[model samples]
Target: MNMLHTQLLQLKPDDIIVEPSVTPLLAGRYRTKRRRQTLHTHKQFDDWVTVSGVQKRRQRSCKVCALLRGDRNKSYHTTFFCEDCSHGEAKCFLYPKARREYNGKRVVLQRPGKVGRRKKTRRELLQDGGAADDEEDD
Candidate 1:
């Protein structure tokens, strides 16, 4: 737990990327454990909610969910915000058996977040003085 905290604190905001999930609305903002079932929990101590997936899953800062909340009309075990994902255990149950839909829509390891989420580099941070230290705390 301490090491996770240290690593978490060492992370920079630019290290994380925010994106919309294809299955944008599946579960709620928070999840709990019961009967040995897997569920999403608040991973970040600050709980910024970069991303989250259902049990037998996966996340980004959560503009995807934020964007979909008002539009969804139905949901399933992994429905687009179905909100009754009790059928989930360890295996995936994204509705209609479209397993491929559960995958992340985009990933760019060379960069963080969106294509241009961060325009500054470590050298640039250093140029900004204490700003770099503050960034490390995110």
Candidate 2:
């Protein structure tokens, strides 16, 4: 699957493996060695790869429009806003996923609490002067 493995499979039995400094014994084929590796690949090469995941959007700003606008551009709402406040200046805050700007401020989207709020403990209630009457009276 990797580049190196594909190259090794392409070699023929009689093919010579060249070394710059010195020759290696493994380079030459032996009489008993009938099998040789040949080059083959099932998948095409790619210049770019993508991963899937959830991300925050409101915390970062767009980078491409930043370069274009220089000091005039302001980033907010997970995007860049031009000096004129027009839609043209606004761009995708996320990088690599979209074709807009390659560089920019990152606006992370705010995430709400996934769990319920914690309740006060007995110790906290006692400290606040609400001790149990049963123990105190005894």
Candidate 3:
């Protein structure tokens, strides 16, 4: 409780706090036991309302959920992406099985080389118009 107060105060002016009211829209799977859950129950702490409001910033948009669900029908600006994603490469989100599509995409430059999607062969190992091992056998 006390730590939350300090964290909220330290937030950037542009940052938004994802409370219970806003968490559903941000990430529906967030655990209810999280500290932000306490913010939803405000009647008991009437005095702290003003203090909390000043410190906590509301989320302007749910970047995490948007990237995971990819429900944006209209053209929307992207803000987040997996570090290993590339412009033309296909990839699933960190929890691909849980979602139908990736929440976001990224250029290869932004991603780490080691985190790329599984590949059958390295680009350097590929031979152009040459006899491969299987071809020689045939």
Candidate 4:
């Protein structure tokens, strides 16, 4: 009874375990057992409300020509041009002519001057009685 108990204690569960065969046939069988997609041969209809709603949103029209700016026929190759106004040529009446400054030999483009209140000098301020206003607190 002591010898049988010692032998049972020494025996492992892994020693009696049955492992499956690692052959290609058994491996291929498991690999091919995936679920297939179901086929539906009926035609699906699109929601017309959503489609027309997207189409109903108006696109930006040209200010000069008053036509759709996104039109493919009205587009130019190098620059944008209004078809109805300047006969599809690049011309804008609203655009102001750029002022050119001549400095000796070089001619440079001058930006428009800002229209604001000009700063007066100390002499000019004193002449205008502005110095009395500052001296009043002192």
TM-score of each: 0.17, 0.16, 0.17, 0.20
- Poorly placed runs, candidate 1 (over 4 Å): 24-138
Query: Tens digit of lDDT per residue, candidate 3, span 9-67?
Result: 99996797656664234465664555422211111111222354485322222233344
Model 2 lDDT-worst window of ten: 39-48
Give the higher-lDDT candidate: 2 or 4: 2
Q: Lowest-scoring 10 consecutive residues by lDDT in candidate 3?
A: 39-48
lDDT (Cα atoms) of all candidates against the true structure: 0.42, 0.43, 0.38, 0.41
lDDT of 1 at 109: 36
Which candidate's TM-score is highest? 4
- For model 1 the local lDDT of residue 49 reads 28
lDDT over C-alpha atoms for residue 80 of model 2: 29
For candidate 4, write residues 1-138 as lDDT tens digits. 999999989999877878797855666656667665533222222213345446432222233322212233342212232333443334432112222322122335443344346798888978778668768868
Candidate 3 lDDT (Cα, 0 to 1)? 0.38
lDDT of 1 at 106: 42
